[model samples]
Target: MASSSTIQVKITAARKKTSLLRSLPLPLTLSFPPSPPPTVRDVKTAIQKAHPSFYTVRQKLSLPDTSKALPDDSAVLFDSAGDAELSVGDLGPQVQWRTVFLVEYAGPLLIHPLVYHLPKLFYGAEIEHSSLQKSVYAMVLLHFIKRELETLFVHRFSHSTMPLFNLFKNSAHYHLLSGVLLAYDVYRPAFSAPAVAGTWRANGTLLTAAWVVWVFAQLSNLSAHLTLRALRPAGTTTRAVPTGYGFSPPFALSTPNYFFELLAWAAVCALSGSPAAGLFFGVSAVQITLWAQKKHAAYKREFGDKYPRGRKVLVPGVF
Candidate 1:
């Protein structure tokens, strides 16, 4: 019923609408060199070509002001047409990419004690003259050496890489603490005096009991680590609820390992018979307890009803 000219106009209008819809750009725009917009993979490839240092797995492409990372590298850039225009080097002004590497945790544990011990040997601390000092040094060295061996063979790290700065921080903490313990035990006149030192010597009942407890606690802690490692087989990522062992209450403590660690340090404090050792153990206890509580809450949230209901955070029955 319409005129021929009107019909032609309607047809042209429909064609123009279709063309407009077809020509609409994607939600995201990447400023890169290409005739048309490329796929995310193509963009990554282009970036890699430009900078060979950026690896695909390690590098994550993110928006300028948002924490949202691109989920799919295969996604076409046209799909993100309506988003803000992205430009090359727009990640941030101070964006410096860093390569990540894994260093075994054992290395620092073994190395930190030398910071104090080597100096003591050279500077004449008279550590070897006192049996208590010798015993304390032996215990401390044995503790960390065992830890290093366990880290190398028994433990599995949840994360493959940590920031390089963390290495220095961790090393500093251990090095300083080791220095404090060794210095006080070896150099202090109070510990070397026969009246005070004889009570905590290797042959003394108190020191012997403390040493026994330390040995037991260390062995138990190692057992806990091995048990945790066994929960997940090699080449798999799975978390399982830990069962208790030895003095640990069955299914009643969420972090029996932390408990054993605290006990071990407490024994070390008793063995050293120094206020500094006690202070270090107290501080360590608080830190480890806080960490255990956090881990407990995380486990409860993650596993929900499946998580054991009666589990304490760090202590077996008290905490």
Candidate 2:
């Protein structure tokens, strides 16, 4: 004669095992026929079929499952298959796939070299324009660049590209390594935060503006990096090499990252607490950005109508 508690425990264990078996869905090894070029109906069916399992698992795992079956929307089915047949790029979605690919990959990678080199290159270099804010920016920018590279490339870089590499070799890798060194100087007080004595009528306002601009620049840079990583083919190398830039189109016109860099410089100027420095770097950064933007525009024009239309040369909407 088992105790009441023992009987209850036995029942509970059996119930739990039953629940696990049902949840496991018997690994449908029946090798169903290969799914055909997915129709809109096919996609809907697939989504529906996966939905119940997804929802059940979600509930078990204490997660929310918000996805629903695809609506009977009016369009050709199968928008963008990764490598499947009759996929949805040219004849499927409203957006062009090649352009999408460029934006997703090339745009982000364009700024990699800049971010890669900033910490190593500009950290302590006296500002070319003699602006204290610009100098601080150069340093802070270096710091941010270093942190970003650590996040994005820590596990991604080849062993040869990680630590000390030949800095004087004049190769792209050399430039990249050099930039990292120069940018690193900004982390020190001698490079980053020595209080430069000066007053601008708009120093406070400008500082605020500069902070905002720098924030946008950082966001834009981060966004580009992510988009590129997402777009890279399945088997490509993940190092911060320049190959990612090659396939990119000027989605926002030309040198869109250049635009953000210019904005960052302007913001640094405003925050410089000195109008003279702010004014100087503001002018320089704007001119340089404009030139770069123009060059990118020319390249896009040469590439023809495939380039995205009506987008600003750099800033997303308002140039």
Candidate 3:
């Protein structure tokens, strides 16, 4: 048998060993706080209330108390973390989820059906001749193309709608509508309306040039929108907030593509010999080029050293 003192010594050693084992540190587990979904109204209100400058001077702009950054509640703004890169759709959990589910999915679907049917109905009612109908149909086709792009491509990733994005979308929608109207105005009404008689005929070389210009402009516009749709998808790497200006290739002005579109319109006016078309296209073209230039200068300022210096404004030297 073991001695009592030996037994006690053995028990003490066992207890010490148990204590050491118990004192060993356990692995830590991370617990993330629950994030709630933001409502559409919440996001909208945030944008309206937020500093106007936030909308204006986007690149390299700062927010006060950024450390206490709040969730984006609006359909326009996304709140993402990190400074190196952030995108319009990067807002915190609530805002991000809301954007994907509500704004992006619903808006395009509602717009698409209306866009397609309206042109068809209007064309049948007003355009009588096959040639006139075909031209109007082409305009209608372009409308559907733009709408489909919004639904199939842009809505795929974008949850929140940036102001610049909204502007571009609105402009496109209006431009297409204007084109359709002009076609109808030329074909159906020109004959009946005394003042519009010779001036509105679609056969003039100026009109032909206008049509050609429109076709090329459509191509360029589609290319630009598609390229932007690919790069600025939602949940992608966020860099600067999308001004909807998009990235232009080097050796080109801010939006050389838009400038091409302007020229296309000018050509159309020259070919058509329609004073109305000339006035309308000329004014719109000037406005669009000016807008592109303004946005380009703003971008150059924001990007600083990264911005290309040699790129001209919309037109090479004339601008």
Candidate 4:
């Protein structure tokens, strides 16, 4: 039955529709309001409601006619007729996106402390930590705590969920490498002594300078976060060109909070003088830089002329 506001969407398994056309599985028919036009996520949510076990993350919704996957935020448009055909490709498993961020950031916060405080667990014996080691403990804990708090309170995610595999993969990056490996390498007894950590360990001038830079970097990062947050109002997924405070014109590297994070890590490298610190900084720089580039490109494509030009992905004046 057709209604004035309700549009019926005929959805089918993408693979089954093409490969098993002869079988002709009955498409799952659903009704959605044309007004405020339902989003791809809304359609997927409805399908999930009907089929409790259906993993929305695994499903790829596409048009039956053209068979192109729809963006999560894209509106499902209807023509003069109130009927539309959509396809779903179920992948496998799903997890909340927020859970992923929390797990990733929480990794360093928990593991770093454990490895630092319980030296016997990893080091195989009682070990006295150096002043630099204590400072590193403070820095690592503080950095990740801020990230956790921000993820909980500051950032508004556009997407509600992600594939479950991201949970394990992302956790490994933070928990295994950044958390356990870095903590062990930095706080281990080998790097604790001045002789091994190098003369830089005793350099008060450099220590003071590094600490100062780290503090400023953290503050600027927070500022950048606030500035970016102002772009999208709470409870809405609407995006706009980032403006105010940390953001600059052209937005290439305008208001680069990630760069500030790297700067703080660089200060950690200066303080700890550990190979692990160097490795962490190097890896973080590369990964974050790539992410920045991708984000910039996405913004450009989304906003077009509205998005300011000339901003590099991460590095100012350099891609």
- Superposed Cα deviation of residue 157, candidate 4 (Å): 0.3
TM-score head-to-head 1 vs 2, winner: 1
Superposed Cα deviation of residue 291, candidate 3 (Å)? 2.8
> Which lDDT values do the candidates have, in the order given?
0.56, 0.38, 0.43, 0.77
Residue 193 Cα positional deviation in candidate 3, in Å, after optimal superposition: 14
Q: Tens digit of lDDT per residue, candidate 2, span 245-264? A: 31244435345556655566
- TM-score per prediction, in order, is 0.66, 0.34, 0.46, 0.84
lDDT for each residue of candidate 4 in 1-319, tens digit (9 for 90 to 100) = 4453666777766774433233333344555444567788888887777665665776788887556779888988666786667777765577888799999999898888788888888888776666677778888898888998888988887777788889999998888778988998987877565544456675677778888999998988998898777878888888888865446743346548987888899999988777878887898788897788788789889989887776666766666
Q: lDDT of candidate 1?
A: 0.56
Per-residue lDDT for 1-319 in model 1, tens only?
Answer: 3222100000011122232223222232245434333445555454445445543433344444444556433453332333333222222112111111112334334543553456455455543345566566677778777766776677676544444455666555555555445454444545554635435344578767887898888988888888888888875557787775732455367777788888887876766666666766777787798898898998899889988787788876677
Model number with the top lDDT? 4
Q: Could you arrange the candidates by lDDT from highest to lowest?
A: 4, 1, 3, 2
Off by over 4 Å in 3: 1-137, 140-144, 147-151, 154-159, 162-184, 189-212, 236-251
Which should have the higher lDDT, number 3 or number 4? 4
Q: In candidate 4, which residue pairs clash?
A: 58-91, 252-311, 252-312, 253-312
Per-residue lDDT for 199 in model 1?
58
Model 3 lDDT on a 0 to 1 scale: 0.43
